[model samples]
Target: MTVFRVGCPHCGGRAHLESGEVRLARTRSRTFYAFTCPDCGEPVRKPAGERIVELLTGNGVAEIGLAPR
Candidate 1:
C-alpha cells in the first residue's frame, strides 16, 4: 500500500495514510486535498498546488468534485 505523510494542525501531529484515505478535489480556480488525521482524529483539508495535485493523482489517490485536465 502507498503511504502518504499528512499533517494535522489540530494536534500538531503527522501520520501516514494510504492512498484511499486521501481525497482530492479540484475547482475551477484551485485544487485541494483532504484527509482525517489518524493521530488526532481531525478532518483536515489543505490546498493542493500544481506539484501536489500531480503527486496525489499520480499516486492513484481518488479524486472528487472536479476532474483533472
Candidate 2:
C-alpha cells in the first residue's frame, strides 16, 4: 500500500500514511486520507491523497487540533 511520510512539526516526528478508510481511535470511520503521528500521538485528516503535501507542511491543522491561541 502507498504511504506518506508525515513529519510532526510539533514533536519533530514522522508518521506513515495509510491507505483506504481511516478509522479513528474510537473506530469512527472517516471518508478521507489520513495519517497519525507516532511521536506526538495525533491524528491528521486529508481531504484527498493528492493533498497530502499540504497537511505535512503544517496546513489545515484545524482538523488535527485547533488554531493557535
Candidate 3:
C-alpha cells in the first residue's frame, strides 16, 4: 500500500491518496477516486493514474507506501 498527496492546481488545496485508488481514471475505466478542496470546498475526481503520479513524483509514477502512522 502507498500514500500520495496531491496539491490542487486550483485553490492550492490538498488531498491524500491511499492504496488501490489510482490518481486518475482512464476513459471507460470504472476506478473511482475523490479529493476535497480545503479552500473552496470543492470535490475533485481523479482523471488518470499518470496525472496523479506526476503530481507526487514529478518525474513518473512510482510505488507508494501507506502504512498507518
Candidate 4:
C-alpha cells in the first residue's frame, strides 16, 4: 500500500496516511486534499495541483465535488 505523507500544522508532526485516510475535494477555483492529522487529530487541507489530483485519484482516494456557485 502506498502511504501519503502530510504535515500537521497544529501538532508539528507529519502523518503517513493511506488512501482511505485521504480525501480529494474540488471547488470552483481550486482542488484540495484533506486528511486528519494522526498526531493531533486536527483536520488538514492542502491545495492540490493537476499532478496531485491524478495521483490521489489513481491511488484510490475518495473524491468529492463541491457545487459551483
Candidate 5:
C-alpha cells in the first residue's frame, strides 16, 4: 500500500499514513481529504484540488460524494 505524509495540526507532527487511513469527500464546490493522525490521533482535514484528488484516489483512498443542496 502507498503511504502518504501528512502534517497534524493539533499535534504539529508529521505522520505517514496509508491509503486506508485517508478519506476523500467531494462536495458541489470543492473536494476535501481527511485523516486521523497516527502520531496524535487528531482528525485532520484539508482542501484538495484536482491533482490531489487524482493522487489520493490512485492510492486507494476511499471517496464519498456529497449531494448538492
Candidate 6:
C-alpha cells in the first residue's frame, strides 16, 4: 500500500495515510488534497501544486471533483 506522510494541523502532528485515504482535486490553475487526520480525526485540506499533484497521483492517490472551466 502507498502511504503518504502528511502534517496534521489539528493535532500538530504528522500522520501516515494510505493512498486510498487521500482525495486529490485538480484544475487548470490549481490543485489540492484532503484527508482526515488519523491522529485527531479532523479533516485536513491543503493546496497542492503541480509537483505535489504529480507525486500523489503517480503513487495511486485517487483524484476527485471536477476541473474548473
RMSD of 4: 1.2
Ranking by TM-score: 4, 5, 1, 6, 2, 3
Measured on C-alpha atoms, candidate 6 has an lDDT of 0.90
Candidate 3 yields a Cα-based lDDT of: 0.51
Q: Name the candidate, 5 or 6, with the larger lDDT value.
A: 5
For this target, which candidate reaches the highest TM-score against the unseen true structure?
Answer: 4
Q: What lDDT score is found at residue 61 in candidate 2? A: 27
Candidate 2, 1-69: lDDT as tens digits: 444466665677766654322321212333244556677777764344434435433432223333333
State each candidate's clash count.
0, 0, 7, 0, 0, 0
lDDT at position 14, candidate 5: 92
TM-score of 5: 0.88
Error of 3 at 59 (Å): 19
Tens-digit per-residue lDDT, 36-61, candidate 4: 89898889898999999999999999
Q: Which portions of model 4 show Cα errors greater than 4 Å?
A: none
How well does candidate 2 match the true structure in TM-score terms? Answer: 0.37
TM-score per candidate, in order? 0.87, 0.37, 0.36, 0.89, 0.88, 0.85
Model 5, residue 7: displacement in angstroms?
Answer: 0.5
Give the whole-model CA lDDT for all candidates, comma-separated. Answer: 0.90, 0.45, 0.51, 0.90, 0.90, 0.90
Report how far off residue 55 is in candidate 3 (Å).
12
Per-residue CA lDDT of candidate 5, range 25-58, in tens? Answer: 9888878999988887879889999999999999
TM-score of 1: 0.87
Candidate 3 local lDDT, 6-69, one digit each (tens): 6666677766655444333333434334555556777776544655545544533344333333
Predicted candidate 6 versus true structure: per-residue lDDT over 12-64, tens digit per residue: 98978899999998777778899998888899989998789889999999999
